[model samples]
Target: MTRAVAVELRGVSCEYRTRTGRVLAVEKLSMQASDREFVALLGPSGCGKSTLLKMVAGLVPATAGEVLVYGRPVVRPLESLGMVFQSPVLLRWRTVINNVLFPAEATGRRDAAMRERAMALLRLVGLTGFEDKYPHELSGGMAQRVSLARALLLEPTLLLMDEPFGALDALTREEMGIELLRIWQEQPKTILFVTHSISESVLLADRVIVMTPRPGRVAAEITIDLPRPRSGRMRVLPRFGELVSVLQDEMGIAT
Candidate 1:
């Protein structure tokens, strides 16, 4: 079965003008993600991984070349995509359910059905009773779960996640990865995830796009052949270590 392409970047480059001069963050980088595929942008800091996500979301304009989503050119911010950043970025005053429904409310789509969907999403992320709580009342992991739920409120077909678990402790980070996979299985979406962890890239992604530093480009594209519905037990597998080692070498890490 041939899967449809969800995102395609043709010779895409992104540049920014600093006070010093022009800084090329990404240069002639091209990549694509298939429909409902989980693709991770795996690279070190300053590699423009997050920049690529912004271009796909139309938050940043490509300095050269084209970005296409679902076979259409992306000229403006896409309405059919959801984004979750490093921080949960929840409104302090608003309760969990309100934060989740904020998108629908802002777009004038908020109503009974939308509210019901928000509750269901909260439940999906295992935050059923915490809907009435404020951001300050929740722990780091719980806050991120709420962020995940909010991102899924409208059920967008594409999800752009920028190290959503990067801020948590090691144990919590591991827990969230498992939780994310569970949620994804239940509600599948084409996910373009950005991360710097080699093990995380191997664990969460169907394919890892290892990138060069600074003026980012694809260093390598590695397909993860691990069986799906992945668990922590798989992390101890020899194949898993091999895949992680491959990513490390691509990043020039002495592993």
Candidate 2:
């Protein structure tokens, strides 16, 4: 059976009014993520990759065209979606479990069942014993794990992650990618991830959507035919290198 479309952008454009006149961030860009798909948006800085993600979440208005989620037009902030930014953005004062419970508290669903679910999520992200730790006490990877758990707390159908692992050291970044895949497989939600790293995109995405420089649009879309349950060992495989090379070429690299 064909998978349902979870997120879509139809000829979407986003323009900002600035002192320097109108600045176009995204121009007539279109793309779709099917149900439970892991789609990565790959582009350089200022390419509007993050802008497109915001449009899907209804955080940013589209200048033209339509943004849709689960077949509904996105005119306001979507309730059934979660977002993870580059920074973990955890509240400094809240403990890890409280941070995970924050969304439920905001939505007035902070009950016994929700608290139980929050603990379960912390366990899912491998943070079983760190629930009471403050944000400053946790290392960068641990903190991002808390953020990931928090985002998944409500069990949103679609997850928008804007370069979520971009700030970590190289080794930690690779670990997070594998951990994310594990969580995704167990939880099974549609994910739209934004990243500037070619290898990271190739390792994490089912289909990599390459965006053009400024005023972003689709430059290419490449499907990663690698096997599921991906691990770091796969990175050394010839096929993995080939896919990374293709994405590099799409970004104007000659190798």
Candidate 3:
């Protein structure tokens, strides 16, 4: 069977109509992702990584060219895609399973069957026994797990993550990275993640697409050949360090 195209950006660009003047955030950016591939966007702060992600999500209109998902033009927010941001953003009042069910209710997918699936997702994210607990009772990592489960509640074919683990401390972030990889392996999806950390990109992505400074464009595409089921010790491997170094250099980040 031929591989499918999960996402395709053809000379896509996004410009903002700001108070001072029109700002071009991304310019002539083009890329392609195969089905179930995990691609990360790494760059400096002002390089418009978020803008590119939003455009692909159909949350931002491309000022030029096209953004396509599964060969369909992205004209609006796509229901087939799931998004997880830096913050968990869970409603404090909602219980763990209820938070995961929020998307189902909002999208009119609520039903007995949907509720069962939500419960399954909560278990997948390791929240099996915390179904009735509120967000306040969860740790930072646990809250993010809820966010991830909520994102996957609809079983979206494409997952867009904007620094989903960026808010956690060093140790928690590492644990979440491992957890995310495990979840992705168990349930495959095309993922587009944006992160400032080069090591994080090397650790999680199949390929890292580095962006240039303002008016961002693809500066480099680094393929990660590391072995799968990556362990924490992989971070200390020579090849891992090399991949991280390449990403850092592309992003102009000091080593």
CA-lDDT, candidates in order: 0.93, 0.95, 0.92
Q: Residue 253 of candidate 2: its Cα lDDT?
A: 87
Every model's TM-score: 0.98, 0.98, 0.96
To one decimal, what is the Cα RMSD in angstroms of model 1 from the true structure? 0.8
* Leading candidate by lDDT: 2
lDDT of 2: 0.95
lDDT of 2 by residue, 1-255 (tens): 799999989999999988989889999999999999999999999899999999998999999999989999999888889999999999999999999999999999999999999999999888998988999999999999999999999899999999999999999999999999999999899999999999999999999999999999999999999999899999999999999999999999887
10 residues in a row with least lDDT, candidate 1:
170-179
Q: Candidate 3's residue-wise lDDT over 1-255, tens digit each?
A: 567999999999899998999999999999998899999999888799999999989999999999999999998989888999999999999999899999999978899999899888888888899999999999999999999999999999999999999999999898888888999999999999999888898999999999999899999999999999887889999999999888888877788
Q: Give the CA lDDT, 0 to 100, for residue 117 in model 3.
A: 93
Scored against the true structure, residue 64 in model 2 reaches a CA lDDT of 98
Higher-lDDT candidate among 2 and 3? Answer: 2
Residues 97-208 of candidate 1: C-alpha lDDT, one tens digit per residue: 9999999999999999999999999888889998899999999999999999888988899999999999999889888898889988988899999999888889999999
The TM-score, computed over Cα atoms with residue i paired to residue i, of candidate 3 is 0.96
Runs of candidate 2 exceeding 4 Å displacement: none
- Ordered list by lDDT, greatest first: 2, 1, 3
